[model samples]
Target: MRQTARPAHPHLLASPAFEELLGGGGGPATMSALRASERSWRLLVVRAVLDSAGSAPAGPLPPPADAWRLLARARTVAEEAVEELLAYPAVGVWAAHTLRRLRGTAEDEAPLWVHTGHLHAIAASAAVRAGLEFRTAVPVRRGWAVLPALGAMRVPEASEPSEWAVAEVVARADGVRVAGRGLAGPDWHPLTELRADGCTLLLDDSDPYRTLRTPAAAEPLDHAAEWQRLFGEAWEILCDTGTGVGSDTGTGTGSGTEEARALAAGLVSLVPRPRAERFRPHSASSGDAYGAALASVPDDGEQLASTLVHEFQHNKLSAFMHLFTLYADQGAARLYYAPWRDDPRPLGGLLQGVYAFFGVTGFWRRRGHHALGQFEFALWRSQTAYALRAIGGADGLTDLGERLVAELARRLEPLLDEPVGARARSAAELAAADHRATWRAHHLRPDPGAVRAHAEAWADGRPMPAAPSAFGLASDGSTIVPCAPARGFDTRAVLLRWLLADPAGFDGLRDDPGAVVSGARPEDVDLVTGRTAEALRAFRARVLGGDGDPETWVGLGLAARAEGDAAGEGLLARPHLAMAVHSELDGRADPLELGRALAVADGDSL
Candidate 1:
């Protein structure tokens, strides 16, 4: 007969911090559910690690026999962490400063780093209690390495040795023990430093990291010392909490590399962004509790620090979710419009996005006071507040989920009230607003009656009074339009999409059939492609009398303008034709601008 599995080790259950984390914000039933989840998680984590079998990333660590034993006995001090993920255990359910509903299913394969990071934490605490420094249960290999974390909150002096001994502490039910060589005096084995004051970028030649970022944009690092320095500086800035870099120093715990430092400081690992993810960051919906922080190189320390904190918060919540369900029914994965996103996300995705960004706002909150990055401050704070308001009490949350969300809102209250500048405020308002409009265009349908009424009113030459749209949206709150955008991220892309969606964009004005060019006017298209000023002016006159569409006229005018003119800029505020702007001058004049110029020059044609 098959044997039944025993409960998790008593050491873990005996820990108050663990009990409090799993049991907080819940009554007896909720706590009971959490306890069951905790036990499941413990078993699942161990089983998952074993399932990986002989993965390379885990190659150099202690033998599976020794490692598995220590892992089973490991104790966690995981009190719902926020803002920062000190080592692995202190990962907050959400950030300390970020408040919002979290959404997503508890159905992803937790990354290896999570189990390792958590175990690392337990081992670290054990060592400190024994009055000895701790090292990683992971050893250095060609592509993978983990170093000792900085002990305590004490800052190290410049001249002092920053390096520490490397160890891989394995655990058994009876006790925990350290395994690995190079445990003597200050050692540089875990990380190979490239530059002084550089965040030691541990060279991961391992297939997992290399393959994970194999895409051209996110291929493994160039292995330059300079690359290491840039990353190191980012860490140093985050460590400077005085500058508002969040509470963690981003140091201590495993090998002294920048990522390890962050992991030690309660962040997940730093994963390279694939080329496509250049503008934004991402985490698995299933939650990669191991903490994969995806980013490109850092040109701005503040932005980088904020990104680190933002993604870190996500990893924390991802882990938290592994222990409990934040929403009521996974089957009811209702999609909603989020203020800062382009596509519709499920309720779970919306919550996760907001939670991550709230922490990001906090990172900037601290820096904004000192750096005076008013715009960044304005944007993040306003956006976060809007998101919190939208999801704070919307629905689908369990009783436990409600309490946690309430606490998050309580923490967010102070952060949300801080002041912001006009430009930032405007952007904050615009982002959500744009998201709603775009969502309506994509997901909402105007009532047929309203549509017919609008048509008749327009034809009658007297428009109906402006009021809310009579859109037929679902009652599940999936159709809630975001309230926060004034503009879009890229007008060019927006215009392209608009043109594709609006049939009239190609058909031209009905009264002015000549408005849109059926085929590219030779001279106008030439003016844009050839950069000929003379051709542009002549081309403008050709389309001038024709009641050509706005796009046609804009193209002519764009080509006629003197060399070096800011193409399409005049259309920035044109609510009707706003989508045509391109990054590089589509050289030809925008027909709208060109047509207007002609109307001013000669009124007889009109």
Candidate 2:
């Protein structure tokens, strides 16, 4: 008897097949299932260029004529970089990274490179359009590079994804080759030093690089030793860590050098092909595997190992997503709170984040047992537990997503349930609560129509409904991102936290007054810090000066809410939560949270 399979959801049936399609997070690819993987992102350049040229973007500026020419040249170089990678064996990590770029709808806040994939397409396109020409020659260690420079024209940082359209270097029998026009060689009195491991780490602040991008440091790299040390360390750490996941680099393979070679080979084959493509995400000393192309390699070996695992997982998923259904169709686009990010993200972004961090949590979990000291062990264990539970908060997963999540949970069950010290537990709790609060604030949108009705009745002296149903979810999550990225979590909280500090820090605060209070009224700081009597005196002094600032408005609302004011509460809640959320890593909020509205705020803080 031939049994037919049960029907798929209507949305899934209606779902179009991926043809150079974007955004499954980093799932399986569609177009590359048949065509060469290299073509995916290059095609994306064509689509994006055409769309932008036709649409006339909303920004004040107009598109440059050279934009098309640059886009074309960048596409060619990006394809070549991919082709260079394809020389290795199977498993389309390059395709994975590239497709992720092609499909992602792109958060306006994200850098161009991250939005596109593998190559820094946006920057590269601009460079070519400006009449920049690149030469073809492999790079070597000993002598100065002979490549000629075009001029003093400033260029975008070649490290960012959409910004950079080609790898700085490609592998060859003699040495690693340097690519890109206006790329002055070392012998040509060049500020750009080409390293053998396939990167153009800036040696000095020359014309274009200085104007184009602000890298963390312009110090020269000790190319050979530095590269060897990082690779060896990363390889050794992976072999020692048990919980490491992914195909080539994730497993606990043989010796350090052996693992390093395999991992290096895989990276060169995929990910912008940089051993350390440091052109993107300039100043953050954290984690990143951009569109799964490049991994920001810091000096520390352990950090490098975890980074390798993290980015590699992105590489794997970016490809795997094309073949599988990890998230539901209808709800996949709904924004959710990702513990690691300050911003709200759709299902695909959320999944990529979770998957990447899963490797991090696992590295720490396993490292605790191997080479870690006592303090390190406890820290890693607690952090791992924090991430494990964080993963559970994700919604909109399909059956496959559930299975994957379940499997990861099973592996981490021991660590998740493991007992830890009080400090560790407190940190974890704070982290969990923080994320829950952020999610509530970002995802929830009160019923504007209902609120309007209640407000109108109040204004008209008409009867109002008793139930709070007037304030509920929005029909559409329109107000999710409401304002610009905050300069600080709360300009008010910044002052409060400072003032709340003991008398010992008073001198420091007084010395640097600008940062202490920021935009908040100093008197409001006093009131929040329990200097109420003084605050009252100060407030009265300036009470009739003029219309209040945004902070004053926020303050009035807060007092009203405390005294049981409904209209005031709704009116003020919007401003109260505006960039008011704090992160454990101070001065940093999740990028996903930027410009999004929040339904929740830590009220007590207010």
In terms of TM-score, the best-performing candidate is 1
Instruction: Estimate the TM-score for candidate 1.
Output: 0.49
Candidates' RMSD to native: 15.4, 13.9
Q: State the local distance difference test value for candidate 2.
A: 0.37
Expressed as tens digits, the lDDT of each residue in 467-493 for candidate 2 is: 321121122222454333333224433
Residue runs of model 1 more than 4 Å from their true location after superposition: 1-205, 209-219, 242-263, 274-286, 369-372, 460-606
The CA root-mean-square deviation of candidate 1, after full C-alpha superposition on the true structure, stands at 15.4
Q: What lDDT score goes with residue 20 in model 2? A: 15
